[model samples]
Target: MTGVPLLDPEIPLPPDFPNRMLTHMFASPIETDIAPSGTLLGLLQRGRGDGWLHALAAPRPDAVAALNHCVLRDPRPDWQLEHRSLYYARLYRELDAPLDAIGEHLFDPVDALEECEQRTGLALSVLGHLVTAGRQDALALLRRYAVTGANWRWALDELAVREDDAGLRELGPAILARFPGTEAGERALIEAVRDSFEPRPWHLWAEDPARSGQRERLARALEIGDFDRWQRQLRPPTPQPGWSVRAVLDWAREGYEQTPRQWREAAAARCLGAVAGPGDREVLLRAAVEGPSPVVRAAALRHLAERGDPAVFELIQRAAEEPDEELAQAAVTAYARMNDDGALRQARGWLERTDELGRTAAVMLARRGSAPDAPGVLAALRRVVRTRGTDAKELRALVEGSARLAIGPAVPVLRHIYRQTISSQLRGHTARALAVTDPTFASGFAVECLWDCEEETREVAAHHAATADARVLDRLRSLAADPAEQEGVQTAVRGRLAPS
Candidate 1:
């Protein structure tokens, strides 16, 4: 009834195990270390194929327990990125897993105050997948949580996608009650309406004849949301004072001091480009070499890089060797953005360096470099995936490079990455790549891709899944006519079915 019981009675808890991790846990991706890939927990957490194979071979209770532990604890440090819920949900169905642990975890008293997605996001997401898989209990729990759970917004999103109109209408009063007629409440309601992942429930509520009061409130919120968006668009960011090089430099220094994010430096660089003159070159160059602040130096580096300054490459190489990792990283990033002949040549040299500079160079070449660059891209892809796993930041570009260059050796690595990655975004991209490179795609992964949680994935499946199979036509037809389907997906679906 509390948190999920320790990996079934067949599996003993580790001696260091603390309380049900649902309570008294510190969740930070910075601290989340990768588990040993050979272990079932590691495999499941990483969304790897071996994890599923191991789970099936392990005692059913132990496998279910390990799974429940993962769902309740929320393994991924950045819960928002990399999607494991659908993957986990499929595992659950494969095992015909019980929902008692999931139910208990969602209802645990800790959920009342601890609504941060880090706490229960995985559980909620897994539940959504089960709901789509025709699990009534999962659907029921989502509805219940939507009213009382701290993370009601997420639950509402899950329900919006699959729940019936009658069921969704029942939630309007409970949800609306949380935001009263008070000014703060009104603002919150407006934002909620504006930000809901799916707008169907709001739209349905607004059209319901019986919920006149709810309809009016939703309408008012929508109108305010539209006005807010219009206002934001009207306010284009520009120099506070009429443009001057000194003023822009001063502005960058100030913005950097206030909140030194990389994006601010990039913004300042754009402003500097507009105001800088032939005479101002000395000052900009001086700032790039010996700036008072990192913001100024980074901005100057970006500006020089963008303008293709003859001396820019030297400046970049120098900064990259400097002690400040931040500036060094900035320089490398700036250099990576360049696509001209010199930059491409420089990238070839970087392929041999074993640092972040080298990593970004591989990504750069993967994205824009020619077919001859395939060997280098393939090598980087294998090395990064081996050392850092599929979730590495460079994974997408590496996969794309493989497909673009038609790197024959990359198919194995791509397939491994597709199997191991927790990111639906990454998986969808891999699917796109595989459609081009993998000979087995149409009859293999593409068939199941149609049932994937992400619509982009479904669209990919629609385009490439072997139409010789009977189910392919059925799925395509269903997608073509489904009002909830995305426009791009519908286009693919209709194209596949137009002849029939």
Candidate 2:
């Protein structure tokens, strides 16, 4: 199968088109120049609601072919990131698309059992939606897949949402047969029964006389799970008031020696904070500086920083400069949390250094610095981008700080990150920064953002995109009328359309 040529929006593919060609078509970017809503393929790529409208209006065979390609292949880079299944399902209901393509795709011999869920999850979700829309064919197809498919648990859960007891009862033996009669299989079945998203089908099967053994196992597992949760709550390893500060520190050190978990040390720090008396300040200060274990030392620093102890600032400075990466990071985190003016002053002094501690100081200033600190934040953002590029996750705080401080010089860099970053969430943060800093945002990127895959990005566009362009107004109107549009987005659209 070869890729489909870029065709006119109105043109339909031949009915005999190959399935692999559809995959190739989606693998490449859409070639259309207009808004994604203008073409069926482009709309699908963007996962826009307009795709549903466009697909419905396209030639029936062509639309069905395109929709099947998407459901079967799973085109999105991240399925969890985009909204496609519900949109595709709604179109299926409107078009009454046949189930043959779906069945063939589900039963394809090439894909292994491991790949089945990822490949068919969207299609299964679509079928689930269609069944809810009262499509008998959809329900029957779901039942067939649940019994025969490798991702049967997913299919079963879908059916559980809409299928009645009688419809569900007939499938118990087939579903149960997948689990062997061995101990391992029984354990797997217990886990499946315990973790099921929808319990209706399991509940129904558990009551049946033929499945009494499976029912007893499931009930036992559920009881143990509940009791375990209760036991954990009743005897949590919290700090007691009678323990002295040294004992609390030793208790923390004991956990660190056994498991070496960072969070355990942090929890212990909170315990030390509760138990430490005024007379124990000097002892804690000494531990923060020279404790035997780095975990104990870091925890002491964190506790002292929280207490607003004056002597701890120099200790933080020393720890921040330490060669040990974990201790340094913990020190920087503690320094960032401090509310003292001296911490801010120290942050300003350290902003010129080019090491990790320097970057940490810049981030601290970006987060807590006033408007006067915009230049330093902008400098840190550019330095990180120039050195590490936009893919750095560490740039998130600096990106947000650049926006919060409204640094005009940061707009170009922010725009660069927005354009080049693959992360939808990062792009969202960039959009928000642009909304505040870019004067022309309403007339520029805001228009394109209306078709963004992330709802929050769309919400930002809705609130800020200039209504001057015909495209923006049309999209706003479409979003306002679509019941499936997020409530935050619709609220923004209404605010824009509201009579002044």
Tens digits of lDDT, candidate 2, 1-500: 00112332322223322332343354312121212223566456445434555576689998888777767766555567655666677677678889889888777764344553676787888888788778888888899889988788889999997898888988988888878888888777767876788878877887766677767765665676556557777995865534688887777677667744534557867888778889998899888888878888888999988888878778987998898888888888887788778777778888887877678788888888999999999888878776665656667788889888989888878876765454556777888998999997888778767766567888999888878778788878977987556799899889988889
lDDT of 1 by residue, 1-500 (tens): 01111132322233333332233323342234444444566657656434665687899998998788778777664566655787688789889999999888888898776746677778888899898888898988998889888888889998998898998998888888889799999999999988788888888887778988888989998888878878988897754634887777778777767734434577787888788878888888999999988778888998888888878888988888889888898898899788788778878988977777889889989998998898899888877876676678898888888888888767767776665565657877898888899888887768767766566777888899898867678778866765545788899888888876
For model 2, the superposed segments whose C-alpha errors exceed 4 Å read 1-190, 197-228, 237-242, 259-263, 481-483, 497-500
lDDT of 1 at 209: 87
- Top TM-score prediction, candidate number: 1
- Candidate 2 local Cα displacement, residue 29, angstroms: 20
lDDT of predicted model 1: 0.77
